[model samples]
Target: MIEVENLTKKYGDARGINDVTFTVEKGEVLGFLGPNGAGKTTTMRILTCFMPATSGKAKIAGFDVFEDSLEVRKRIGYLPESVPLYTDMQVPVYLEFVAGLKGVDRRDVKRRVSHVMDDCALNAVSKKYIGELSKGYRQRVGLAQALINDPEVLILDEPTIGLDPRQIIEIRSLIKSLGGRRTVILSTHILPEVSMICQRVVIINEGRLVAVDTPQNLTAQLQRSQQILIRVGGPEKEVLSEVGKINGVSRVSVKENGADNINAYLIELKKDMVDAGKDIPPVIVRKNWSLHEMRPVGMSLEDIFIKLVTEEKIN
Candidate 1:
């Protein structure tokens, strides 16, 4: 439901985003992932028409963001990084005012405001002032206001940042529930959150679109070598040497131990071949080394991100 092509933005030679291009399908939740200063927020701002790009084109819900900026604005629900809230106004009052500004029919304003308040779980605090509420509640109020117009697309930038653990999960669940009807493009550095909620990811770095794929695919390609950690009660030297000699086993790395006892080591294998958990235990048993503990070290998304983006920098 969103398309950006060669969208470039610059501020007097200070780069914002360059050569950025991507699209989000209808019903797709696209996770915009990158480190800070990676131009994620910059892209969202351009899409919302909060600011125009220096060059290139973008369309939201099929209308050009610049040419049909008003139509695009009407179709989008944007929860920017810092939700601009009228701290003095009470919840229902603030939303009602927003509804009028958005040109909601006077007869339908109450119903519309009530509906979003319910959806965002703000019904209980509809009488509370925005400034009096905690950060979590204020964010909920921001989201409530964003939904006041019932826009078809939701563009949330770091929506859950600075929230406590409890607040984070609650907001995440709320965002997930808002799916099916609204296409979402969420920009967050929280990798796990992206994997959990997004159908696909658009990873960017240094104003460039680096990679776009399913989280599973990205993690798998970078998982070239697998490693296992093991602790045994018997001869560490012999067990380490023997595992290194096995077919498909590439290297052996051991942890430092006291002079009299050494019981732990890391075994590396060709990632595609050896099932380290199934193979290594038997080897230690055959060598008469009491295998106290053995566990495979699965590759993580963080590992893949660091490897890919860091390599991009060097090249």
Candidate 2:
């Protein structure tokens, strides 16, 4: 329920974001990823109505972000990278304050605060002042305030930036649970978080949109060749020479295996060489070499991300 078209934001000669365009369908969780100084926070601030774009257009839940700021704000709950909170306010009191600011009815504020506290696992700290809470608890309090309004869309920027592994998992689970009920735009540099939590990803670099696709699709699109790892107990040179002759095999490299007389071979095949995996085993067998193991090495999200960013810089 979000649409952005050629969104551009700039501060004098320095570019914040340029020609940034993407969409988040209703109930879709979109991961917004980029390296430092890549305009991720700039884009999110524009989407959440915290700042206006220099040009282009955006709509949230069908309301124009620039023209209908109030309507857009009412439909979106934002947790910025640095969450703004009243340190002296108690946990529950903070949420109640947020609910009121978001226009929740006075009578329903109590129930709404309670529901968000439970959702964010902040019930135990309900009576504690935000200033006295741990960083993790403060993060949860930030999230609880974001959800206090039960908005149709959630815009979270680095929701798990400083938490421990356990706290990160808890927050990740909470974000996943919100999917299908609220459209979410999660902005973070954490690759695994994008892989585990996002349905699709929008990657930006150097203030430009670099790639946008599901993680699996992006991996497939960016992979230039197929890689297969094979270990064999045989003469290294002979094995490498024979494997190189197989149809569709483009390149091969051999590394010394730890096991005695065993060598590990990394074989690169032509793009879309689906049958090469099956073709190489027989070649080794013809030479009477004992095959130890064979498996494909798929490119991970991190690999694809690095490749995209590096390529963008080169071009």
Candidate 3:
């Protein structure tokens, strides 16, 4: 329900985002990822109508962002990295204020405020001032305000920046629950959050769109070969020779396992033979080598993020 086309922003020559473009379909949760200073926030601000782009166009719920700023803002709920909050107000009061500002009917304000407070697990501290709450509670308060109006689009920037592990999981679950009902654009440097919560990812680096695809697709796109780690008890040279002869085997290298007589090997299979892991053990058994371990090595999101960002710099 969100579309950006060549969205560019600048502060008098210092670039914010250049030719940034992507889309988030209805009920789709899109993870917006980038390193620091990569323009993630700038892009989000423009989409949320918090700021105007120097050039280009953005639309939310089929309304042009520039032409229908009020409509766009009404349809989107934004929780910025530093949530703008009234520290002196109690949680319930603060949320009620936000609900009113978001155009929630005066008669429905109490029900809306209470529902969001419950959804964010802030009911117990409803009467407590925001400043008196812990960082995690404060973050929840920020999220509650964003949900007060139940907008069709939610734009969150660093929603779980400083929370502890437990708190992070709570917030992550909350975000996940909102999927399929709200179009969400989550902007964060946390890779695992994207992997666990986002349906697809849009990666930017140095203020340019680097890649946009499903996490699995991006990993597969960058992978040139399949890798398998195997541990066997046998003479190193003999084991290597036997495995190297297997069809689709591209290369074999021995790795130190720190155990006597037990050698580890990293086998690289040709790109077309991704399932080569299934063909390895039989070769070892025929040679009388005792296989200890056999597992595939998959590229994680962290690895993919670093690889893509570094490649962008080199090119």
Best by TM-score: 2
lDDT of 3 by residue, 27-144 (tens): 9999999999999999988998888999999999999988999998999899999887888998888888889999999999999998898899987797799989998999999999
Better-scoring candidate (TM-score), 1 or 2: 2
lDDT of predicted model 3:
0.91
Residue-level lDDT tens digits of model 2 in 1-315 = 999999999999999999999999999999999998899999999998989999999999899999999999999999989877899998887788889999999999999998988899897987799999999999999998889999999999999999999999999999999999999999999998998999999999989999999988998887789889989988877887888998899999985565777888899989978567789888888889899889988999999999999989899
Cα lDDT over the full model 2: 0.91
Alpha carbon RMSD to native, model 3: 1.2
By lDDT: ranked, best first: 2, 3, 1
What value of lDDT does candidate 1 attain over all alpha carbons?
Answer: 0.86
Per-candidate clashes, comma-separated: 0, 0, 0
lDDT of 2 at 307: 91
Consecutive 10-residue window with the lowest summed lDDT within model 1: 255-264
Worst 10 residues of 3 by lDDT: 255-264
Q: Give stretches of model 2 more than 4 Å off.
A: none
Ranking by TM-score: 2, 3, 1
